[model samples]
Target: MILELVRFLVFIFFVITSFMIILLVLFQDEQGDGIGGVFGGGSSSIFGARSSSVAIKITAFFITLFLFL
Candidate 1:
């Protein structure tokens, strides 16, 4: 019973993480402007220049987690 519960939880986590990864990738800017450019490639950025690196790290983490799960 516990094993089944654990498996279900992991599956749920994997699905949620997958969606998060997709959204993160879609929201990020290809021109290195970070996610702030999704709305408008302007001089203003909500996450600043450092957001790109942060997003990359998060994406990597979720990908690794997905593989493991």
Candidate 2:
């Protein structure tokens, strides 16, 4: 039925989105440094160390949505 097809598509979309979000979240570096100071955290980061909180939040949201799907 149309409802079943819609449900299936929604499930697939959620699964794919969750996987992408997870990959991105994991790919982000947690260390407080850019490409240069990776080995040397002792040096102050020129751009400053940004927090991964946003990525974590997004990943969490995707996970919750995936579970609902």
TM-score to native of every candidate shown: 0.63, 0.49
Q: How many backbone clashes does candidate 1 have?
A: 0
Q: Which residue pairs in candidate 2 collide?
A: none
Best by lDDT: 1
- Over 1-69, each residue of candidate 2 has an lDDT whose tens digit, in order, gives 999999999988987987877796677656655545423353533233643345544655676677777
Those runs of model 1 whose alpha carbons end farther than 4 Å from true positions after fitting are: 32-52
RMSD of 1: 7.4
Model 1 scores a TM of 0.63
Local error of candidate 1 at residue 6 (angstroms): 0.9
Query: lDDT for every model?
Result: 0.69, 0.62
